[model samples]
Target: MQVKIEKLDHFGRGITYVNQKICFVAKALPNEIVKIKVTKETKKYIEAEIEEWVTISSYRIPEVCPYAKICGGCDLEHLEYKKENEWKREKVKELLAKFSQIEKVEVKEIKYLSPYHYRNKVTLHGAKNRVGYYQPKSKNLVPIDTCLLLNQKINELLPKMKRLARENKVQEIMIRTSNDEKESLIKISGDKPKSLIDMKDITGIFFQEEQLQGKEEIISTIGKYQYYLSIESFFQVNQELTEMLYEEVLNEVKKVKPKKVLDLYCGTGTIGIYISSEAEEVIGIDSCSSSIKNANHNKKLNQVKNIQFINNKVENVIDQFQQDTDLIIVDPPRKGLDKKTLRHIIRIAPKYLIYISCDPVTLARDLKELKETYQTKIVTPFNMFPRTYHVECVSVLVHN
Candidate 1:
């Protein structure tokens, strides 16, 4: 059936009505007319694939990557980068008004840098002789030699890594590079490849529970702070934008002048440490032990004296810091805060709350609940994952 795409969804899929039900067409753009075949259907929505394009959007651009259509790593490669940034900001505003009931939202212009070769880490899966990213929503592997979204160092290492994956019969491989591009680490799920142990630029090679070569971590410098990242440590993918994101948080911390800061889902304690000088004391909590270990190492690496890292879930330890926490910053996973955690945060009701979110839908939903005890407004969008639907936001809320 032929349909004109009304707009793009949050996932970068085009939306139109089919049989009075919303249909999502993959790879279709706004104002584009396409012939679609229904791939799946349900009571709420329909999924379709574009069989033919009758009309094309002017905003669409030539994809720089050959595997853009098949690779699941990026979504908006067909859209112009300028338009992509605007759409991201509008999506954040739309979600906030729709889900959070914040109609007069003032979302700052989306911040971004170069759209290509920004990723510091990449994970590829191997099947038989093929090694590459999996197709979206499926386990099918698409053979890839290079990804435009990865750092140049990672793209250069792809050939060797692919060969190693094929020869060693490894099921998965994760490569991480430092921001300076001076250090690199590889983690594999199968046997340790002897060939990779002495690879140039490789500082570490981890196989399962053991380190095959070099040190256990690599150091990355973001802004003025340095962090040591282990194989299992969590760090932002975009190095430049991460510094900007943290700076945004630091600006808010400066305004609040929080005496005691509580950071939830702190990961490697980047945000807490970034704002430590402004606060009298800072406590960061995360359930990932490896992350906490890295966080403590980073604490000493930066010589930060006013911060402490705890290896525990925020929901479990939030109450302990309730009384003295002047500000609470949460950088939650894509699922956002659970009801239990939200309830506890509401009970604690710190003077200031800053939420850094990767998913706008979940962020808006949580902001709605947070509006009960906090004045929610002023969200700033960061193009953390350009060429993809993901957008990071920093929302500052003052206690009511």
Candidate 2:
């Protein structure tokens, strides 16, 4: 029952071995001896939930949230902020070394942003029995007063929003509040559209938008540049760190002064348009037709002519990639880049490759394959989703 946690995993769970079998222990800290209840057991490893801390580690601190264990919103709330940064830094290093085997890749340091209230979007689900996020790995929903990671406005609006949501006929209602808290829209997707007239507190526009669809451009600004983001377009959720992320990517892209730049998986052409001024010409590629349309609208809104938005898969447009491309920036979803797309980028062999990833495991795996043709110059980790296991990382690679 008593086990010593050895290290932290990608999902922020502690790793320990019981009888030579690895066990993923949740709510336990490294170098801590704790009693745990076996939740799952397999041939290779076991899964456990901490029962009690027989001997607490020095690194352990009282969690800020009373719902730390029950609520699935945060993973590292129990650990100290400084220690969290150290563990995250080690996480990226281990993933890169283990998956990519890139010997000399220098991960500068894991930058720490404000851990609390860093998230811009919180997607709350409404089930038949309850209304909240699903428990860790189970479908059981744990109702809560507020999620600490969400912005102050969203946290304040949860109860009213929940009441309004219950009045609606739809089972799942997703509320997305923009960074500025200017455009607070709720999408009641699904076949059922019910009247929300009973709720008196709920304000702002109701999108009534379809799932995986886009609408008219919504104006958003980061630093000096203003962007038009479609309701369905994918953008970084953290506002405080958005400018920092774009600056880091822009710094890397401008280092090469690329004549031609490619933005793959470009959603609404936010990044392409933001960095278009640095390059002679920029091209953005995406599979979403609506996203491409929004990207074009964004370009026109910004009055930028150098960046071109194309509606196509990254791999499909690989053939159209000019050999003279000097820089390529990719901001892929959590699944990371596919093998076909990664191979295409390698084949193109741009002078510089900038990859912005939200998942470390996939990023590590892709970096391994890319190291054969490119060398990493810097690996910068940004805290996009704080109070959670998710992290956004930027890796700049130069053609070898």
Specify the highest-lDDT model's number. Answer: 1
lDDT of 1 by residue, 59-170 (tens): 9899989997778678899999999999999999988999998656679999999899899999998888668999987999998999988999899889888778767877
Candidate 2, residue 234: the lDDT equals 76
Model 1 clashing-pair count: 0
Q: Write the per-residue lDDT of candidate 2 for residues 124-185, one digit (tens) a residue.
A: 66665346777877877777677777777667777765665566534555555566766554
For every model shown, the clashing-pair count is 0, 1
lDDT (Cα atoms) of all candidates against the true structure: 0.89, 0.78
Model 1 lDDT, full chain set: 0.89
Clashing pairs in 2: 100-368
TM-score of 2: 0.92
- RMSD vs true structure, all candidates: 1.5, 2.6
Off by over 4 Å in 1: 191-196
